[model samples]
Target: MALRMADTPTPVRHHRRSRRSRRAVLATLASVVTALVAALLAWPGAEPADAAPSTFAHPGVTVSRGQLDFTREKVNAGAQPWKGAHDQMMGSKYASLSRTPKPRAVVECGSYSDPNYGCTDEREDAIAAYTTALAWYITRDDRYAKKSIELMDAWSGTIKDHTNSNAPLQTGWAGSSWPRAAEIIKHTYTGTWGNSGRFATMLRNVYLPEIINGSNSNGNWELSMMEAAIGISVFIEDKGSYDKAMAKFRTRTAAYVYLASDGELPKTVPSQNLDTRAKIVKYWQGQGTFTTGLTQETCRDFTHTGYGLSAISHVAETSRIQGEDLYKTDVGERLRQGLGFQARYELGEAPPGSLCGGSVHRGLGPVTEVGYNALHSRLGHAMSNTQKLTEKNRPAGSNNLFVAWETLTHADNPS
Candidate 1:
């Protein structure tokens, strides 16, 4: 019968038609499958039209639940470096039980040259709050948790505005720690924080608006502010704010960290109006020699450069926790190069005469922990200079401006 059908002209034509129909069906299926995969890759965890997860997903933000648990386990097992760093944090004044939070109606901090009265108190209290939170997390002590809540509530309830010229920087400094403390206390602590809502409101109303717009001042100013904005956005579960902060962070990071591929000059923020080469050179502190790892604030000093680098790492880490891996992107490369370049100099490499007039101002601070953990341990990147410097500076502590207890949180953290 098959031979008879094959020999039939009509049947042969029918068979050919069937084959074409099958091919068309298969091709359509393949197109659909390809489209779905493309969509998934383009926007992970969100529909093509929908925004990403909004609201503070517990164990989200800069530190994830897995990471916190890992830290706790290491600390409990009395792991070498973790134990030492834990002792360092718990022994500091920031963790003292007798610490009192001094809340002000208005905090007015001038630049370094002209400081204000409550500037130190505000910054220290914020640090102390974070310290107590770490203590609570490690020890399961109710007292420490309560103390952390008290500090947050004190500032949230009393502080209405940050005034004067140093307002943004002050807010950035305190704002950065508040969310880290809040995330730990709100998610991990079993104790009831009645004013936690007020704290959220404070962040959303007072801090978020101030920093979300991004700054055009020195690169450090905007970087630190965006760092605060990004952390607060995660805590509040505001995906829109998070996106804005991340975009600005990318721009500022590129401008701050120079790469050889960027031609003879470092990149500048387009909005900053550094259109002319001369203008860009001026903004870069007149340092014309552009190379990998050179920062916009390098000529200013390493201290400011450290601020920029720390903020970039913090934002990038937070983004990674949110399921968006910035480390695999250009942002990550910039951060890695920036950290390596700074670490090399910090490790006692004298500057060449072609760069910064043959001398570099060194004060990169304790800012290498998160970046080191991400690049070295997780990704298996060879960062010898950063690794050596990080090991040499184990139990990295706070810089007193914003960065604090990074070694305790991020040192060799696989999670």
Candidate 2:
């Protein structure tokens, strides 16, 4: 009596059976995919999915065109710090119109630059190029743009490779500035750079190959390397390299800056294999106790610690210029705490002997401008110590490495 559709070999029954089978197969595939995705995520050092920007902003390496325009307006209006900073930069040897560029086919650097061959020259030339580009933007002077182009062309034609122990770090330092100059000159400067493609080729072949993969050395080493890689990728518009460098920046920032939430010890880089607490403490420069703002290099010294912070700020600033506000994220939080901690000590606060054996080194360098500007000016964070330290060191000039003229570019800059 219940002669259903299954009793008869009808097309409807066959269709129903087929539909049920398809649903079962689909469910099985979904389960398998979930398991595979979970496994891949658990795997160490697994590369993250690509998240490159679909359309990159021009002149978007550590500075935006709008920011440049704003700075120009401020400088033209005879503003306090902007005008002073511009004058300081213009007076520096980097902005000299008759400056020369010294490029080598090979650059060699050792620990602390023992055998420094072409190391200082490369770093200075790169900073000079960036300075001229900034000058061109602020003054609308064709001479500055041409000068930047000339410096870039000289290096591109000459430099073939970087060699030795500090090659990666050296490349990272120089690489950071070159892209800033290139991005500004190429996108904003009206003057022609006939050899711009050659410069791009040089960066792609020589510099990118050296630092794109990042360093496994000190946290500062990797931080600087990623800084260079991020800027270079934007200048070259290399999407893959951009993604890879951003990933490295994120990971290194977490491991470099400690937060109270990161358990008793600081977070470790998986590649560094800092599995045990003992290994982590040793890797953290013998600093056993972890604080919210303690850096991996705090016990090592504050100078290198400053380097790490500067790199983080530069990369975060670049990301912000490219339509992402990293200053509003955990990156911003770490930067604030790191700056505060270093600033408190640099302001001559007596430590409790728990930090850096109670004798932490000073001289935090010209690394506070960008971070202070972003966190305090834009996001409105109350940083009395950072403000005091930043104002005390106004008109920050070239560190002779990567950082240069930050006071001019980032002081109270909202954009």
Regions of model 2 farther than 4 Å from truth:
1-48
Overall lDDT per candidate, in order of appearance: 0.84, 0.89
Best by TM-score: 2
TM-score of each: 0.86, 0.91
Best by lDDT: 2
Going through the candidates in the order shown, the clash numbers are 1, 0
What is candidate 1's TM-score against the reference? 0.86
How does residue 198 of candidate 1 score in lDDT? Answer: 96
Tens digits of lDDT, candidate 2, 313-409: 9999998888777888778999999999999998899877888788888888999999999999989999999999999999898789999999999
